[model samples]
Target: MFAPTFNLNLTLRRAVLAALLAAGSSVAMADPLHYHVEIDTSQFSGAGFLDFAFLAGNSPAPGATATLSQFSGAFGALDSKEGNVSGSAPGTLVFGNGGGYNDWFQNVSLGGRFAFDIVFGGDFLGTNGNVGTTFSLGLLDQSASAYLGNPNGNLLQFDLMPLNGALPASIAASTYASIASISAVPEASEWMMLTGGLALIGFALRRRRVAALTA
Candidate 1:
C-alpha cells in the first residue's frame, strides 16, 4: 500500500514540476516586444547611417539594451529623392538605414506615409532609466548601398521616449508627433517556450503511465 502511495506522490510531484516549468517559460517568453513604425525619406537624397541608441530618461549616455545576440530588428522600405531605401512593397524586409545627407528628408518626412517595425527584449526597459523605451530610425548619407545600424550620418530621423514602463495599445503607439507606431505582435520565443513546456508535460505523463502498468 505504501509502495502505491509513494508512486502516486512521485507522480504528483512531477505534475507540479511540469506546471512550474510552464509558468517559468511564460515569464521568460514575455519580455520580447514588437512595435510597428513608418517613415518616408523621399523628400531628400544622398547617403547616411542610423545614429541613435537607447537612452536614459534625459541623459545622453547609452541605456540598457537586450542581452540576446539579436539585439534589435529593423524592417522597412521607402522611396527617396536622390536614391531610395530599396525593398519589395508592402514593406517586409530587413530595412536598411540610409537615405539623404543635409536633413532634407527630416524636414519633409516627419509625419507622412511610411512603415517599419521595431523589435527587442521588452525587459530592457525596466532599468537604466527605462532606456529601451527610447527608439530611433534615421537616414544618414552613405556613398554606396545604404546598410542598417551604422549611426551618426543622420539625414532624417525619428524617435519615441519614456515608454519603458509599459507599452500601451494604440495610445502610446501614436503619442509621437512624427511617425506613428501602429500595432504590436508576438514573434517566436513565446511560442517556442509553450511548445517545450507542453512536450515536457507529455513526456512526464507517459512515464507515469508506463510505471503504473509495470508496477
Candidate 2:
C-alpha cells in the first residue's frame, strides 16, 4: 500500500512540474515593443512638398539607437530607406525622391500628416539627464537626397523635445504625441497554453487527493 501511494504522488508531482514548465514557456514568448511616429506637415511651408525626414536622439548624450522603416500607406511607394543608428545619431536612408541628391522639387508634400513606424531595441531612460533622450527631425527637400539639408543647402529641422520632467519609470504600450509605443502582450494561443497548464495542475492535485482518500 505504501508503494502504490508513493507512485501516485510521484506521478502527480511530475504532472504539476510539466504544467509549470508550459506556463513558463508561454510567458517567455512575449514580443518586443513597437514605436510609432506621426509628422504633421499641413502647416509646413516649402516650395515643394516635404519629401523625407530623419529622426535622431540627443539625450544621455547618445542614448539609444534604432532602425526606421516606412510602412505601407500613401508614401509607401516613394522609396525604402532603412538603416541603423546609434545613440541619438542619424542612420542611412533618404525619405524622399529615391534617396537621390539635388531634386527638392520632386519631394513629397507634407501638407497634411505624414506618419511612419520605427523600432528600437534599447532603453529610453537616460542616466545623465531628466529626459533620457531628445529626438530631432531633419526634413530634406525632394531635390536633395541627403538627410541633413536641401539642395540649396538649407537645413530644415524639427526637434521633439523630451518631457519637461524626469522620464517615467515605466511607460505603457500606447500612443503619445508624435510618437507611439506598444509592448507585446500574450497571444491567444499563449494564454490558452497557460490556462491549460493551470488546469492540469489543478486536476493533478484533485487526483492525488482522491487517491489518498481511497487509500
Candidate 3:
C-alpha cells in the first residue's frame, strides 16, 4: 500500500544522494603543486650578467635556450627564463665592466600559491668587496624597469655573499651561488570553500534526481 510506496521513495532519494555525493567527491579539488628551483651556474660563467646576458633565446646570441624558473607574487610560480632579468656593474668586475650586460625580461606563468627561495655560491660575489651587488629573484610588476638602479619598480633582490677562502689572494672578493626551494599551498579557506560548494551541489543534484524519479 502507501507504506511500500513511501519506502520506495525513501530508498530512491537515498540512492540519488549517494550518486550525487560520489560525483562531487570525484570532482574534488586537489592540493597545489610545489615547484623546487635549482639554478646550475657551473657551466655558465660565474658572472650573473654573463649568464643573464646570453640566456639562449633572448640573448643577442642566436638559437640559445636556457631553463628558467619563476614565481608569481601570489598563487603562482616564478619562471627564470620567462621573467625579466637584469643587473648593474660596479665598474670593478672583470667581465661586466662598463655595463657589459643588459637586463632582459621574460614573462612567466604558474598556478596556485607561490614564493621563492635562493641559494648562492662563492663565484657570484667574485674577488671584489662589492658583494652588495645583488642578484634578484621575484615577480616584477608592470611598473618596474629592467634597467640598472631604477629604484622605482617592484623587484626582489637576493643579496650574494662570498665563500670562505674563495679569494685567498683578495679576501675582499667574496662570491656565492644561488639555489631556491619553493613551497606553495592553497589557502585553507579556499579549500574549505571548494569542498562546501561541492557538497552543496551534490545535495541539490541528489534531491532533484529523487524528485524527478518519484514524479
Candidate 4:
C-alpha cells in the first residue's frame, strides 16, 4: 500500500529533523562570564594616591549614572612602575599611584588589583523578559577636589543583582571587591550541531530499517 505510506512519511520527516537539530543546539549555547575586580587596600589608611573610578549603571537606583562601555578599551596603558593607572573611560580603575609621584596623591600605597572580562548574554544583561536586572557600581575619587573632602572613604557603592538561581557572582566593595565567574562550555560549533543531530537521527533510523527489510 504505497510502501506503507512511504515508510510513514519517511519516519515523520526524520522525526521533524531531529527536533530542529535539538532546538538549534539550545540556541547556540551561549554562556561565558568572568569578571574580577579586587582592591582591598588592606584597610586603606590613605596617605596620597587614591583615584578610583569604576562606574557602571543600568538602574539599580542609588545615583545611577550609567557608563560601562563594555569595559571601554580594556585598560591598556598606564605603567607607574607597573602599578597601573591609566583609565579615561571604560570602567576606569586608578587607586593610588604606583611610583610616579605626581603630588596629587601619588605617593604610593593605595592597594591593588583590577581585572575585567564580561559575557553575561541577553544583549549584556538588558533583561528584556525581566526575570531580574540591576547593575550599579559607582566609586569616584579622581582626587576628589584634591582631597579637600570625600577622601576615598564614603563613595564606594555596589548594587549588583541576581541571587539564588545564581548571577551576582561576587562583589564586596568598601574599597573594592568584584568577582563574577561563570563558564558553561559548548562551543565547537555547538558540538557540531549536537553531533550532526545525532547523525541525522542515526541515518534516518538506519534508512527505515533497510526499507522494512526490502518490503
TM-score, each model?
0.34, 0.31, 0.25, 0.27
Off by over 4 Å in 4: 5-16, 19-25, 28-55, 61-193, 196-198, 205-209, 212-215
- Across 1-215, the per-residue lDDT of candidate 1 in tens digits comes to 12364665576676666656644553342433465554443443444333332222343322323111121223233333222122232323222212222111221222124454555433233333332133334444454344322333322222333233454211133332232234454456645655665676676667667667776
Query: lDDT by residue for model 4 over 111-157, one digit each (tens)?
Result: 23323332232232322221222322322233434431233343233
Residues 107-203, candidate 3, lDDT per residue (tens digit)? 3222222333222223323343323233433333333333211224222333223322434211111123232233333444545655665665566
- The candidate, 1 or 4, that scores higher on TM-score is 1
Whole-model Cα lDDT per candidate? 0.37, 0.40, 0.32, 0.36
Comparison by lDDT, 3 against 4, better one: 4
- The clash number for model 2 is 11
Report the number of the highest-lDDT candidate. Answer: 2
- Best TM-score goes to which candidate? 1
State each model's C-alpha RMSD to the native.
11.8, 11.8, 18.4, 15.0
Model 2 regions lying over 4 Å from their true place: 1-32, 38-63, 73-106, 110-113, 123-131, 136-215
lDDT score for candidate 1 against the true structure = 0.37
Model 2: per-residue Cα lDDT over 82-184, one tens digit each: 3332221122232211121212122454455555555433333332333333233445545446432323332222222222344432222322333222333
